[model samples]
Target: MINKIDKLKDPLVQEARELSSSKKRIFKNKIQLRGLEQLMWAKYAGLKIESIFISEDQNVDDYSGFSSPTYQTSNGILKKITETNYLIPCVGVAEATPNNDDFDDFVLLLDDVKDHGNIGTIIRTGKAYGINDFITTNDDFDPYIPKTIDASRGTAFKVNFKRYKTPQSAVAFLKEKGYQIVATSPYGKSLQSTVELDKKPIALVIGNESVGVCNEVLEAADHIVQIPMHTGVESLNVGVATGISIYELRLKEVLTMLAEKIISSLGRKVSVTSKLIRRAFDIKLKEISEFSGDQIIFLMVLKRKSQMNEEQIGEQFGYFGDRLEKFISPLYENKLIKKEYEEIEITNAGEDLLAKLWPIHEKTENILLEGLTAEERKNLKSYLEKIQQNCIKIMKYEV
Candidate 1:
């Protein structure tokens, strides 16, 4: 049942107030909320709403599926959303914990960054670029504040973050686990010139706005990095600096993601092209015979169904008249084929060469037909042949 407490001294109200404050910290599973936007976003993220408080005149239909305890208040005491004292139409309390997964090789650490708004922006920007795990030093502002949530537009609730007692402790633990510490500083090498990211499993530290990274923390960094600015500009906003640094540090992942998108748009045709297949076969079967692609393909056709005369061979393999003669004469001189009356047959030497190259040819076939069922492979071959005939028709029509 959703409990409604109108009095300011109610125990639930006290708990909500405490949960909403930064100085008095309680590691409760609940978080403070404000506005319809925050409540809706929390629900969209699939968080469990513990309870909700609404104004006396507001209809409950706006919050349909949530079956939590609903409270209607007239004094607007429960409606004081945050320290800003804004009386929003509705407020909610939802489960604050996110579905946290294992951390990636790259991590973002905040060192004594006391601004709540800056912390929220950092979390929002970090999540956008694939850095979900964040660690905060003890002096850093609490991420659960209403200002933080408002600044992030409720993205703060969706990110994975942990608060550490000190920057040194966090850096020490990360270093022990093989993460290189890279701290941002105004005096450090420019981000464009930094080569530390060539090494993986890096922890990028963004510091307080006023004091910057603590001297002790800066001393512990494996590499200190900075973004270059124009001569008159002294520094960048912490949030902006962090965003740029994260992009530069994760540039490899960003490029790989873009390449995958391009490849996906073009389909897997890149892997199974005619040119690539021809090159692979040439390289794989070079030892058996010094035959070109046309010669090898012609020999394979005869090997499967022998005794093919000139016109019949042309019909079967698309070789005609002079082209057919060119393919056969070279094989005849090499003792690979014999002329038996009107029909041509592969000679003993040809059979020996085919036997030597059979395994490689079959392997090449398997590579081309990979990830397909037997039926699909047959259908694909039929489709390709149809496409080839269509191409021939289009060429003849143009001529």
Candidate 2:
């Protein structure tokens, strides 16, 4: 015999063997490794290895390539294990539990996903997408099974996984923590197009292989989103679907966060609304006439005042002399403005252009208040007036 069989009966070996069984184990503080790959993964995850057992033919020096210390080995039952089609050359023991509270921002909820392969792939893919927290319904399938561990490539050791008695329990927990529950289904709005995920701290629930997300869980969700599919393909493997959804949703969240950061940083140095107004005015002006924002302001002012001398317009807008004239020249060339000497007036064409431009301005305003209620709009207007008052006070050097 190339290896000893009595060593497999060691307490640690028995623990590893028992862990491989189908029994449900909670709060797993110890993980059993079956191969060098899993041991390497455990090392990478910073897990403290309690012990290592390798086949007699394998050299400890070869396995000691990792950061972990070399260990004494025995040819235990591992060498004589004929039950499994493939012999596992090594088995490792290490820490496996993660704090439930450590998961933040985004979480993945698996609903009755019975297949170990699917669960493993989901964890592996979710980790790639920045999802560290995984919750599964109380099902018989063990996420730490050798098959799952093998498929996850040991990513299971890195994930903060928790099991709930039911999907409803998971949803309730997330909801209580202020997470927006987004459920995946084949029948809902397109995942790519849905803006529901604009809300932060998302808890994405993916359902079982055959029946999809449970009805109770779906009913509890704040939004139902689905991936658009081609004809004849009724559904996707839960693992594949979860991976796709996580990629799309997590990327959106990251992009949204980056945009918010950029906006905040820019807000300290420049006016966001002012930039938007200038850009939107330019775009709207392009559609109507060859007028810049300054010229449009002058046109609207002239329209309001019915006509004004260049000096008077300059006094009102603080734009005078050659600069004022230069600004008006483009408008005049477009037939939107007519100037005789110092007096300037808006022509019929200018009036029509301004009329068309009013809708664009309205559209922009509507866009800003897309989801706001009437009361919110009223409050916003009041708030803007207060801001104006504060600005005036600052200009006057008032405290």
Candidate 3:
């Protein structure tokens, strides 16, 4: 008669069982990466591997960093590892534990946000807006899931996130120490209301899209804020609303550097309330009409396109002879802007220069743009749009 337990008798399984029972171990800790489980007993966890295992024998060492384990299995171990005739060989025993501390800055707490996409997009938005820390209710979608990581587009590694069995406790801790707790809700006040943000510290909270913030946490929050919606649209996607909110807070409160965004959003036209630094740049030029730098008077146009031809420049500033050219030329030559085919671009040099004299640029750009490389922004926006679609896809059912 065939043995009922023959499969379990493979020597490889025997080895794993034996090691699992051992006690001696060593580890490293008491530092920033202060709470890792695998490292807690690195000696045993590190060396207890029975043998390298693989489903099928093939080359996997193209990038050895992701390769090493796939290449070192004995023929006996291979058969035993593959319980089924079809092999299933990849295995490692690192305990999944959230022992990371770098998640303190602007941590996002997701309270029962059920949709996986919403969770993913919120994470992407947090990363975009220079927020690198997050905490989720115990039931929030799994951050370690491959789909969630894919949604983050590598941002998962940059940010620190942990799952909390509860967010109410986190809220209480934050409120006690003066962190502003703002919640998202249909019933919240207008979006443009002034937020008194402290440069010292702050936290913005988001709730489940379906039911809104829990009453318990809602009562616990310092304030409940909302994003104003158009008459037709019901509400913003949790992720989109979060991105816009964070954008406003970071650009306005975090730093005053990006005056252009405020200008750009006010309809491709420039505004008159000149940034303090720009006023300083052309302080003397205000005397003449051609150089009439009435920053306040012209709310519609701010900087004349630097790349404009003499005619275009003349249209904005009355064409003047060599004297005026000498004056306007400096604005062009400094690389604050460029004129080509009558178009202009504010260069990095220009943006930095604007940032120095004004404490605004660093805070505005750093926090609003967050740590997003240019490419990441495109991917994030695209991903957010995709998430919005999936949400809408699901949302259509409710409507």
What C-alpha lDDT values do all the predictions have?
Answer: 0.75, 0.75, 0.52
1-399: candidate 1 lDDT, tens digit per residue: 334567767666666666666565336657777767888778876778777778777776876667777777644575443444556777777777753436677788898888888988998898888777887778434677777888787777777777678878878877777777878888886463454454447788989899899987899988887788899999899999988888887874345355555666533564447668877788777756678665777777888888788888787667787887776788999999888898888888988888877787888789878999999999988988887798689889894
Model 1, residue 71: what's the lDDT?
77
Q: Model 3 compared with the native: what TM-score?
A: 0.46
True-structure RMSD, every candidate: 9.9, 16.1, 16.0
The numbered model that scores best in TM-score is: 1
lDDT of 2 by residue, 1-399 (tens): 122345656675566565555562344556667788888888888888876667766776767566444344544466333136566778766767555766678998888888889889998998988789987777454677778888898888888977788777878888888888888887776565565465568888878888888999889888888789899998888888888888888877777677666767844434777667667767766775566666667778889988798778776666777887686777777888787776778899999887877777677668767899999999988987887787778889855
Q: What lDDT is obtained when candidate 1 is compared to the true structure?
A: 0.75
Q: Please, what is the TM-score per model?
A: 0.62, 0.60, 0.46
Better of 1 and 3 by TM-score: 1
Pick by lDDT: which candidate is best? 1
Give the alpha carbon lDDT tens digit for every residue of 123-153 in model 3: 8788877887776665333553334434655
